[model samples]
Target: MELPVVKYNRSHYIETDTGNKVSRKSVIYGSQNITLSGKTIIQAGCVIRGDLRRAGGGQTLVIAIGRYCLLGENSVIRPPHKTYKGVFSYYPMKIGDYVAIGENSIVEAANIGNHVQIGKNCIIGRFAIIKDGCRIEDHTVIAPNTVIPSFSVYSGSPGRLVGELPECAPEMYEARSKEFYSKFMAT
Candidate 1:
């Protein structure tokens, strides 16, 4: 079935803080159910949907993107809880502050800590825990139900823990976030 079209009533185009523009043709549903806060960027051709089972369910899909998050073009983010038993449920995608994700990536995990970078075309498995100060390189496939501890970099098919990130310091993390906000966001 073809997806429904949504018109952006406020603006002609959806321009994110990271200088990413979600084309007007893109579909954004569950506006009443989905809440977007802080400075975040979501690119073009992306789909943001809420609960599918319950059309009138009062529960809204919570995708909390902390300050300075860059969701690349054509990315998809859904709530944590999966629908089973022929029923729709609500789950929260809790994202901490200062996270950057590359293009065409799929994130359905839980709690990506502060200052984490997930590369392009990557798939973050369910229940995979990515702690703070972690960097996932491009094209890395994070296996399902894997856990990555804090301050580490994992790059592989199953996402092995390589080591601590180069800039584990909180100061460096802040700096990088600022750079992303300025370099990519300000455009």
Candidate 2:
């Protein structure tokens, strides 16, 4: 899909050497625990809570956003936590390359694989695992601990398996993400 040109105020963002564009209006707490690989765009009003780390540990990585990813405006990317064997700890959240999370979404997934697209206003529950080439439709609510297989499309409140995607989904999604990044201009 071809995305329209979207422009932002130049002074409101910081463009890094590796093509990362981070909005100043975004709230990224405990930034030390968050990792942006390269060419990642984090839009305004986004909140990345990296302070929530694993117990009995140092300042380890909590959230890792892979290369060429997009975290849309007003979205929240938080690490998932739970009590495992009487020890409460926050698990690591990994979002693979070429992932695009739409606006106003709240994601607490443990692992989101490559070329995944999560639509607007979605809520990905804690510990949910989304495999490669998967698409979660808008307004969907993924159940906690749910595992979405590769090349699948999920939708609705419970985020059931809607359909399967073509084998070329990875290449298509990758192109889309790169195109979106290239068209993200500062005006």
Candidate 3:
């Protein structure tokens, strides 16, 4: 079965293929360069701006979202701009396969591992490392430049390591990953 095709307006030097299922309401600039594949869904109201320059007319920002990932409603992922010196040069927010980012989560970070679930309204700061199989609960704030190793459950403001996930959270995250693959990916 062939998938449905959708297209939107984009500026020069930007490329979006029919493999991606993007919403009409999602506004992607023409200057930004993004490559998406394998059942990628750009949900409604999601803004992926590849142009990092706040002043405009600069080199386009490069955003690479891996396969089988779900960027929830209204989630913004982009490189940090010079306007905020505190988060300058924070680029290449590399999210691995099978990652689920909840709504309103602002991620201007370095790397997010595979099978990670970041809850709603969470703040993952610049250069923060979220390892594989980690569950960052809702409203959690991961401070800048911190490292969360693999197989941990993170919650609370200024997020800290509460404890191990009783060996169930990882399973749950994997299950969710499978569901995403079935429902969104492999369509």
For all candidates in order, the CA lDDT equals: 0.67, 0.95, 0.69
Task: Please give the range of 10 consecutive residues that has the lowest summed lDDT in model 1.
Answer: 1-10
- Which candidate achieves the best TM-score against the true structure? 2
Model with the higher lDDT, candidate 1 or 3: 3
Candidate 3 lDDT by residue in tens digits, 39-143 = 556666677767653344555536667666777778887754343656544355667767888888888767888778889999988778888888898999999
Give me the displacement of residue 49 in model 3, in angstroms: 2.3
Best by lDDT: 2
Candidate 2 lDDT for residue 34: 91
Q: Weakest 10 consecutive residues, lDDT, candidate 3?
A: 6-15
Backbone clashes in model 2, listed as residue pairs: none
Error of 1 at 34 (Å): 2.7
Compared to the true structure, candidate 2 yields what TM-score?
Answer: 0.97
If the candidates were sorted by their TM-score against the true structure, best first, what order would they fall in? 2, 1, 3
Clashes of 1: 1
Off by over 4 Å in 3: 1-19, 30-32, 53-61, 81-90, 166-172, 184-187
